[model samples]
Target: MPIKTPDAANPCVFISAEDVGKVGTETPQELAGDLGFLSNMEMIRQAGSFRMGVTPDIAAAKQMQSVPKVAIVAAPTDAKIQSGKVLLGTDVDLVVRMISMQQPHRAVPITGALCLAIACRIDGTIPARLARATLNTLTLSQPSGTIAVDANVRYINNTPVALSGTVLRTARLLFSGLVHH
Candidate 1:
């Protein structure tokens, strides 16, 4: 069953390793390697469409509808960090990369991070399987440094429920401007 917050405006979609094959042919590790040299967001979008077995139009529509935030949670792989200064440690449980229609194709937003944290706590998802016992937080290793999310999951009748998730983000006010449409 796909778990979603009942009243969420844009609910997160969690795809496990097994079900990921239904959505995309390439795994997260494979996509990471293929995306190594590509900088164009359009090309990345096309690749994602091909892997997900959807036309560009259909993918766009789906991104607008059912699953806006799609994440692939897989077992950790040896990936170069953002600076190329260091490789990720093997202790990292799972690596996640999200694709969304509302933001840049390659960027990981706070919503994606929170979704991954919630997915990590769910009982049967790949992330939950790979997650280590780390108290109440799940550490996600992205291209940048690790992001830690504080998750509180409560279970009712043996089903897990996500009560709340929190992630600390650092942002700078780049340019405050008004857009005149």
Candidate 2:
């Protein structure tokens, strides 16, 4: 589903689980590097995950207007990357984790929403713990906390359609600078 008002921040982008590129592992340093300063995506460890020694790059959260489209998921084999943290990312239009550098590990709801949407799809593309909890509600293990995203896909002759696409995102926010004073 697409965002209304172009001012909201839930469901940043939607893509089928099977559409992501090959998966990859992220080094602790890599996940902590300066990212999302505007374009580069990065992660912030959950408060619980961070207590186990996950470090977040607070410096990278610059004045950039774009939120991340990246994700750090927990595949079955990805129980722990460092300390007690599970940081597995995909070549998704993923949102690098929107973890805050400090506090309760605040994260944007859209990331959790996006991730849960991927796992809850009817397709079996993502085989993981999160993928198994699709009874109705999905519990997303975000760095800050857990979030649940409910989705409904309208099938026209068995084909899934993206209602809003990315036009609103680019046209209203990303491209605002080009057209706005």
Candidate 3:
């Protein structure tokens, strides 16, 4: 039986088998490139936002029985410099949890980087019209894409926007001979 809501009626978003198939094939490939490189990058792209690899073992946290579960975590680092006049850019982190399990922890990096980059582009602003134009020229958007959520806070007299978010990509189901539909 189909489920129904009290006020509205239909679901917020609907994903057909075809839509799911397209998402499966195109999303990760376009976003992360090869899995090996992506994994390493996600692990290394330091700055808080990238969280694709390791997360808390929630099941373990929830359990009164067994050991419960495990998790994967990533730690990244980088170096940047502001020469001439000092410029402080807002620091943001976007995170995505692609998969989860119990026992141990792990994560993929390239996907995390791409996901964070897209999110930063979406919410960050430019100093001027010219600067914004240049940034648009240099930015790239992820295709199909991973699911990411943002956590933002303003700091230092609103001079910098500190943000953190998570992204997710789910495995697709195979049906019959076709990819999905």
- The deviation in Å at residue 155 for candidate 3 is 3.5
lDDT of 1 by residue, 66-135 (tens): 2445555556656565555443546465666565642323435777777677767778766687666566
Pairs of colliding residues, candidate 2: 36-40, 69-93, 69-94, 69-95, 70-94, 70-95, 71-95
Candidate 1 Cα errors over 4 Å, as ranges: 1-10, 16-67, 102-106, 169-181
> For residues 58-120, could you state the per-residue lDDT of candidate 2 as single tens digits?
333232213323344443223233355663422122222333332112343554354346434
Instruction: Report residue 69 deviation for candidate 3 (angstroms).
Output: 32
Which of the numbered candidates is closest to the native, going by highest lDDT?
A: 1
Between candidates 1 and 3, which one is better according to TM-score?
Answer: 1
The window of 10 residues in a row where model 3 has the poorest summed lDDT is 6-15
**Model 1 residue pairs with clashes:** none
Off by over 4 Å in 3: 1-153, 161-163, 174-181
User: What's the distance in Å from true for residue 123, model 1?
Assistant: 0.7
What value does the lDDT take at residue 9 in candidate 3? 14
Q: All candidates' TM-scores?
A: 0.59, 0.37, 0.21
The most accurate candidate by TM-score is: 1
